[model samples]
Target: MDGGQAMIALGIGLTSAVDGAAIAALVRRALAHAGLEASVLAVPDWRADLPAVAAAARLLGLPVAPVSRAAMQTVEAAVATRAPESLARYGVGSVAEAAALVAAGRGARLLVARLAEAGATCAVAEGEGP
Candidate 1:
């Protein structure tokens, strides 16, 4: 999943005021577990969530991409993991998976499904290019 034109997109979901270190660690573990390198990191475009997501991106030396709630909703049906709480609050089953799919765009597919640790979740998606 590295060494080519294959790009990995990461989507993150966080609880309020979660620490950047926790987010970074979880994302690192998820990437290593999947044996994939991320090209970009993404998060929902909610104002309160941006800081931690941005910090994680900086920690990983990757740019942060924001996916709107509407765009995330469109990919919810395709997400394999369903979190009832997230579905009730965000109108999506899994924020990490849906956001990754949306951020990666139309033909993107999940390379790693949602994985949670320390009040944060991370997922990876690969674009259908190269």
Candidate 2:
């Protein structure tokens, strides 16, 4: 795709709604700095929420792989069992960690969604979520 036509997706992880909003603002600024103008999508937990992330990416006009709801639920259950405390303690670093977890195969993708829904600070780095 042409540089002008290429689209980007931004995901953010936040503890509160305010944090999500702030992250969105920061993302917009960063995009401006990079001369890119894409949208943002929130993902409560990036690591455990691959299904929702894929859905958001598709909504942003990007290609996506097929993910089953049952599989995503399994992922959620695994992560919830391991990290019962909260993601708020993890902070911004969780983003990279979550991606790494997804890259690995210890669990599924709903982990991120659960974190964010639980009030973890998570959103697409660019595009919006479904």
Candidate 3:
């Protein structure tokens, strides 16, 4: 437990609202802000489908969590941002938060609340693993 666990297994959630470059930067910031070692992040399966998300994952070596909608719904309450559109469509405030929580898995907790920047939104969650 040196340095209080250098690396944190963090997760992210996003949509097509962002481009590849921005996604990459968002991902980078998430890792850097966590101040972890050999940083790694996980995104929901749907986010992986986004060209920008895929590109970011490739650029940062981020893992794409094979999460299901049922799983994501389980963490809908944990989300911080409350958007009317997202609530009506996904039953969650932010897809990013839902996905981040799902990726983190059981006992998952928010490390960084949802952040909307550069036309994209993301949230960071920490759990047992990606």
Candidate 4:
């Protein structure tokens, strides 16, 4: 499939209620750096406050994919970066990385690892689409 046909999932982790503009800016930069367009925004299901992420996805015209904590944990072993605090609190070393991988489905690989800005984090994962 062509590059346009490929889907890239963006996983976001937030510590606070960030503004949609901030999240969108970060996602845009991260995606530009990776030379990929995001097909969807993925967030941890346990996170109740998701207005920022939801708004960002709407701003970017992409769908939101809520990944379960179990699914995110399952991909933790494959994550390259390790966040001790995150692991202690959420049982996942890198929530963004893990969430991206899980939301992208099987065989998905990280296109851009966690990129942090203020209270938010972003990661991108690429997967094949049928």
**Which 10 residues in a row give candidate 1 its minimum summed lDDT?**
1-10
Task: Report, for every candidate in turn, its global Cα lDDT versus the true structure.
Answer: 0.83, 0.35, 0.66, 0.82
* Candidate 2 lDDT over residue span 33-125, tens digit each: 556544334243433344444443454543332323332333332232234343344432344223222322332232222223333333122
Give the per-residue lDDT of model 1 (tens digit) for 4-106.
4766788898887688789999889889988988888888888334667767878999888878899888887789897889999999988999878877764
Q: What's the CA RMSD for each of the models?
A: 2.7, 10.4, 3.2, 2.2
Per-residue lDDT of 4-28 in model 3, one digit per residue for the tens? 4323444555656778788777766
What overall lDDT, based on C-alpha atoms, would model 2 receive against the true structure?
0.35
Clashing pairs in 4: none
Once fitted onto the true fold, the runs of candidate 1 whose alpha carbons sit more than 4 angstroms away are 1-4, 47-49
**TM-score: the better of candidates 1 and 4:** 4
Q: Is candidate 2 or candidate 4 better by lDDT?
A: 4
**Clash count (model 4, backbone only):** 0
Question: Each prediction's TM-score against the native?
Answer: 0.89, 0.33, 0.77, 0.90
